[model samples]
Target: MSFPHVTIEGYPRVGANRELKKALEAYWAGKIDEAAFTSTAHSLRIDTYRRLRDLGLTEDYAIPADVAYYDQVLETALTVGVLQAGTLDEEFTLCRGNADTAPLEMTKWFDTNYHYLVPEVADQAFEPNPERILTIVREAADADVKVRPFLVGPVTLLALAKGENPLARLDELVDAYAAVLAALAADGVEWVQVAEPALVADLVPADAELAALAGTAWTKLLNVDNRPNVLITTPYGSLREGLKALADAQPEALHVSLAPSVLAEDPTYVDRVLEAVHPETTLVAGLIDGHNVWAANLRERAEILDKLQAGHPDVAVSTSVSLLHVPHTVTAESNIPVDVAGWLAFADEKITEAVALANRDEDAFARADRAVRTRAESERTRNAEVAARVAKLPEGQVQREPQFEGRKEAQAELGLPKLPTTTIGSFPQTQEIRKARADHRAGTITDAQYTEAMKNEVAEVVKLQEDLGLDVLVHGEPERNDMVQYFSEQMDGFISTDNGWVQSYGSRCVRPPIVIGDVSRPEAMTVEWAKYAQSLTDKPVKGMLTGPVTILAWSFKRDDVPVSVSADQIALALADEVADLEEAGIDIIQIDEPALRELLPLRKDARPEYLDWSIRSFRLVAVDAEPTTQIHTHLCYSEFGEIIDAVAALDADVTSIEAARSKMELLTDLNEGFHSDIGPGVWDIHSPRVPSVDELTELLTAALKHVPAERLWVNPDCGLKTRGYAETNESLKNLVEARDRVVASL
Candidate 1:
């Protein structure tokens, strides 16, 4: 049952110990020199390869050295000279846009949590950067470890890129890639993994033409003299028509994901792939799950492999995708319950599972079975009261009273300004705020002292908003660590870890709370802060809570329950909090659901059911609010084209979305008869840049074309927790002034 080969597609970018994140941040903040940062990255690269070697994965199989300076896509851009200027500062600007410059467009990395900077291909010439690739190869060589170099395939890079005729320069880009391949061969490398995930996406005729162009590029790359054996890896979903296009490239091997693909649901999908692939090419069966925390059912995986091996006899085994999505290891977690820990597998454990499956180790399969059985018997999987409550829920519990017109009439009683202005819930979490929370956690500050510090911050934020003439105010959220994690800490049935950090974006990591059992709120999580902040201002303060769907989307929930069931429990908990806030005289409540779109199922067929329950969960939280009270929900970094129907079904009084980065392009999708009041963001808050009043006015004017001026609100794309006070103040001031001008014209 043993396969001829075993290889990992790639490893995580965050170092095994997160040394790279700390090093990169320190380097950017001018706390360290370039030499120190390079040394740290080099050491991490060497350590990664050495660890893989020590774990019995040799260079002939998995080399474990495809590391990124920041992100693989960014590194891919650097490889092919996509940047107009190749300076480090320009590189930084591309990844993190500054005050004067907008960064490259960012999007989800093919159904995974990782985000990649899209390559800007306008008027850029291609050149090979073999020195950068060689540096990592040599670092592995210095450790006496031979390695396989990884590259984002030409087809995928061009497919995910922006600009006119991105694939028009395909020939030149292929030449550059061929030179890189020849250089790798000269350095004594034996294999290269070229990732082409675009093959799994739904492509139109124009995109199919680009895909064919990519195939031509790959053909040229493999034709390079002394080129290494190249394996084309396609993850995320099944490749159908695109597979036929890629077959013309004639690679030495092809790797396809099985876990998230159609193959997992239907074994007959193997036959379809076999028909599409080149008969002579080696087929690498991706068997292990890479995106989830659950351990693979080894027995079931073996049966699936049996079907694939019948058609392709020399099948190699691998993880379904890169293990980068999961955390590094579970062995370091001592506080987690033993039974729950036994049921889980992190990236390190997943690697071992892959190797075991390759070797057909019976003991590993036996252990996996026992862990699955143990989890079934654990009390963490069952909650009688929660189940009973869910079963008895009334049919109309998710619908709010009196519709949008009545709610709008009640909202006018507050006498807010036209084109009302507000932020997306949080102000900048400055160093003083962070330090105060840290001091409180360390037991160095009394409860009274911490409360006073938080109140002072709230007062300052209230004054700042009033000075800017903002129509709405927020409590600044200075005491919270993360939107989801902050509430998870206060609720029952969740576990928080001190060191369970995972990278969200550049230099920013989140410690997602683990939901182990039935979730419920013991008391109001944000009421005290909301009341205190409202007491400081005559202006209406928006009481904020992270939406149930977002809390469930971000956290690692118990595997036994359906995600809908867990989300329902969270919705009920948040429903109680919403009622408490309304009773406390907080008329405006914002439930933020930024992660809703990110959690959509990659397969189109699987999306409707997920969207149905996810929308219901959001509705269950805000359905009971009084018509006089304004209910707001925020969704950021989402593509609203397909799910705008489900979004309208939530029926919040107001929904603020992230649109500034796309310059109101998302408004086109929203023109299809949406029910709620809409607020397309006026400017990007993720960047440190302060938007000028003129720029804000231009964006607001664009929004007016789609939304009635009376129904449109003005705000930033998301929270300002990651920004600074100076920029936040300037941005809000400009935002209010732009709204004022727009209102005057109206």
Candidate 2:
């Protein structure tokens, strides 16, 4: 069969909404049988396919099985390949023996937080499971929807797989994957998309051997008897190599991302790939930004698509990346003014974009073009007001009453114990905690009841720390759904969605609130919780606040205003909270800015302005505190090697950062320039598996190599909210044991 002219190019069908999540939860809980679960899951796929089918879209099928236990499709690939280390298998195997058994660890997919399950190919007997793909195909078929199943391409899978030398088995693995493709073909799914996003990675795959491997994978997959059309999709980054092989192998179609920055390029990459491709090959052009809320430049994108089509008139339009990067729907953003809302395009709106571009009808194109115009106008209005407000900030708000030295003395007098043990400001949020919040949201429990529940958790956390012999205590942010979302909900300038869930990695979804106005604290945000928790123990309590840069980075901010303005507004609000906490006698505060590094300007030239605003915003919040207040900050998923100086510039009294998994590669950078006290996390928190006391002792020993033992604190890589109680408790016990060992050795 000929490849259809109508192809839909986006993400999977599974949504992070309440209904879908409940069904999956029930399935996991064994409350529903496989048949019942599969039925519910299939309905979602059918609904997605039907929606796109009604609009005449086809290239990609809305398959639910592509979504997995962990939201990462690559993780699904790993599971299919049976790539588990023996130890991991053993740990998960005895889950009933140890209720705190951590699940498989997932690491960042390249530099992005989109995590992929760490594939442990300890042996060579790994086999592909056709049932995974077949399940999706069968579901689509039952729904009467013609679907092309999607898989993370062999190259990408190999890139994400874990081993001493993952690249070593690339050829053999690609061959195995080709065989899997053949199987999918025989199953009557004619079309398949092998996503090789690793093509965009820094390692250029232009070598002859590399090209040969890519060619081998494509030709073998495409050569399957009665195979469906094969489409190679690569997005998020440009293909630096393999273009010639890709064109030469000549799958049914070729897809390339058309981001604003990429579109503005010399167009040479597109032209070369297009020119080199077989004349019969179709081109899928990405015409809309996926990761941001900025309205699509319809005229500009349409013009680019038109230009690309001038060469290959069979060009099809799609989003630059998955709509998963965008919010689920705009309808949930109730607080945004209707005029402003009109300027936005959520996932549903972007689907409309795909259909509009497929028709190439100028009239339909004009409506999108008008959306951009209205968006631009709205932005102009917003920027003018925001800029004026920023220009008039009271000068004192940006400066401290007393400088670092003066404040440091007061903090020391508070007599915090040396080598303090503290958490990253959250304890395990159990099923009970989640239910309480759910009940509150559903009105089954009152706000007061929810507060009491959260307070009880905080009180328990305080008691636990005292029992555990920790120095600094945290309020265990159980009341918050997400670090950024919680603050945004309370602040004056943000709007949250009930169903705006976007996958953070897999089943873990974060509904980052949308910041819409000048940020201001309506009242003291954390004083009550901080004070209550402090009252529970004589131990100094750390008041937790998400830093300005993080709140700006994590939330969907108004592009109409410069990020600096938005950040400053957030900083000002946080500044008020910091003052309130200090007045309420909270002696320690930790401002977490985990997303700061993620938000660094992609271009090197643009970084100074970003850093200036980012650092200023952090300082604006912290400078108001007396140095005696013991200001601490936490950074995550960031390699501080390049910007170590910038990190130091923030002058936080102490900072905790991810170090366990990073292998202390960043320690030397800190040793050279960092002046503040530091806590290089002694253990990896992302993994559910607990580290042994010996493992932590080694980690702490290595940490002391770069940082002085006296200046060091101990903590986990991140908050423990996602972890179960057993893992958290056991891990902390090991951490304390390791510390004691280190102390004894000294």
Candidate 3:
């Protein structure tokens, strides 16, 4: 068996229109049995394999053997022996958890917005479970689909874990990987891709140390007896010391990314790559960008492919990363504008494009060139007003006339108590709420009727919060679909989709709005709801808006302009909403920037500029506010130590964070430098379990050791949109009870 010249790192596992999501959720809820769930997952894998073959990737090892019931990391953990679970239900419990147990902690994967379950690396005995991998391989082979297994490499798995140092047992881990590879080889597998993305990341360890470990891991894995050919992949970041280590190991194939997200480099980069790559090894050039949906310039990429092929004896065409980040296909979409649709390529299109590039199909290249040229020349692509407004923006826009102390003094008039309780905005979106939204969308209900239903939901939320004794209230966001999509749908310069759903985590998918032009807010997005909710409550209600950087990070980025400029334009649009909120008498505004830390450039040298623009974009939202208005912001689901200064620089009156699941671990990073009033979440809302009053009190009490009682607020780790009403109600009751206990003790 030989390595395929055209290959993809992975395909979208969740089916088009989220068939897998529905099936998984149904299985979790016990609506579908294990057999049914397995059947759905089996069908998805078969469909993906057939899709690759249909697109001319018929060669052995061309299709990726990556399918996960929940997450790739969780699946890798199971396959490589780090996690030992007995059954399918038990495995799902490891990620989603039972009502009695808390699941694994999850965080952003690399610089991407997708989340992965964090592996817990305690003193558990390591034993390989190759059944899951072998079964999938066997099934695909039985279906006559030759595939390559793509997996999380040992070094990366160890580096990404949360407990005791797993790298100390690298030999044991890599040996376990060897056994799995041997099993696959026995099952007729020809190639396996071991993803070591951490090698290119900015880890706590020095590059030299990680590279040494990487070299050791690869040397053993590649040399394993009776095993498939090893393909070592380092996605997202540009190659540094990681490349040298892999090149020295002389892997069967070395995959390098040319994604636009990687830092632009010198024209001599191809020469350097040729010099570093092993002479006899296959070099898989990831010429297609997988992180975005925009079309690739085939003419330009073809020339680079020519140069690379001239240098290496064996060169394959592939995407820079997995198509899991994108939707299933553009063919399923019908709502996109004609020119924009012509200039777009989803996961399926990307696979065909890879094969076309590998075969040097000139007609495909010409069609791509024409579409690219048309997009470049389109009148709708640029807006003079947007450019001029951003250009003429005043200097020191992020600087506030009033610091936190002055703003805190002004906010004192609201008489919020120490450890004032609040949610992170959004209550449980009940079935009725969902139905109302769906009916409104389907035009079954009049606009006025829908408004009445939403107002009723808001009123119920306010009264419910007051009864629960929460000091601050939120509108529960029943009218909105997604935090980012709600704003994007109302604003200019973005396109909404009917079937574009990319998996954010397990069964949690987000349709990222496509940014096609200059951004502006033609109208207020949340002011009416905020105003109406405030009218129903004497306590201050938060006027919630997703922050500018988060809005940009969550959406497909606009490559035509720098991200900083796009973020600024979005900030200005949100600034208008902020002003409207103030005019409508909703003083406490929470602008959520949960994706801020996730979007930091992987290279340390490139971070300051990103932080400068991202922080400035966030600060720009509340810069024009009066001193009496309290501006709060939130950041979550990431390690924030690298950007703690930027978090402080947000100049928010209060800052809430996702700290509950990690048990206030983020406080260790804050120390005395973070001066904003802090809310370390008391409940892990992502999980279904409702915590006891005692548990919330202990977390709040621990947080008090890090910050003063006066500066602390109690809240959930994030919005409760995905949670059920029963759990949300009980959780808030326990949270408020815990806050009262802590306040009385103080």
User: Which is the leading candidate under TM-score?
Assistant: 3
Tens-digit lDDT string for candidate 3 (426-532):
88888999999999999999999999999999999999999999999999999888888999999889997778889999999988998888899888889999999
Arrange candidates by lDDT, descending. Answer: 3, 1, 2
lDDT of each: 0.80, 0.71, 0.87
Score every model by TM-score.
0.92, 0.82, 0.95
lDDT winner between 1 and 3, please give it: 3
Q: Between which residue pairs do clashes occur in model 3?
A: none
* TM-score-best of 2 and 3: 3
Q: Give me the overall lDDT of model 3.
A: 0.87
lDDT of 2 by residue, 1-746 (tens): 55555454565344535445666567657798767866776676667667666655654443212444344444345434644323323422322124555445565554344555555555576577666667777777876776777777776676556667666676667656766676777786767776777665543333445556677767766665556677787777566456777777788887777777555442577777667767788877767667666566567676777778788857767767766577666776676677667667787777666667667767766776786677666543444444565677764325454655566566678776556788998899899999999999899998889899998888888888888888888989988887887898888767766667766654456677777657777788889999999888898999999999888777887755577788888887888899999899998899998877777653344578778888888888887687678899998876777787778878788889888887777787874558778898877887688999999888888888888876788888889988988888889888887888888887
- Candidates' RMSD to native: 3.1, 5.1, 2.3
In candidate 3, residue 563 scores what lDDT?
84
lDDT of 1 by residue, 1-746 (tens): 12237777777667767998999889899999889988998888888877776665763637645678777888877876665446666777888877788787778887666788888788766877877778877878777887777888887887788889777777888888888888888988777788888877654334466566766777777777778788888877777656776766778788888873346444556777777677677788788877677787887778767877777756777888888777777887888777778878877788788888878889999999998787777676667777787777775436788888888898888788778899998888888999999999999999999999999999998988988888889999998888888999998878876566666676666667788788888888999999998998899999999998889878876656678888898988898999999989899999999878877865566788888889888988988888999999998877776677777788899999989988988888884558688888987997788999999999999899989987899999999998998898888889988998988888
How many clashes show up in model 3? 0
TM-score, predicted candidate 3 vs. hidden true structure: 0.95
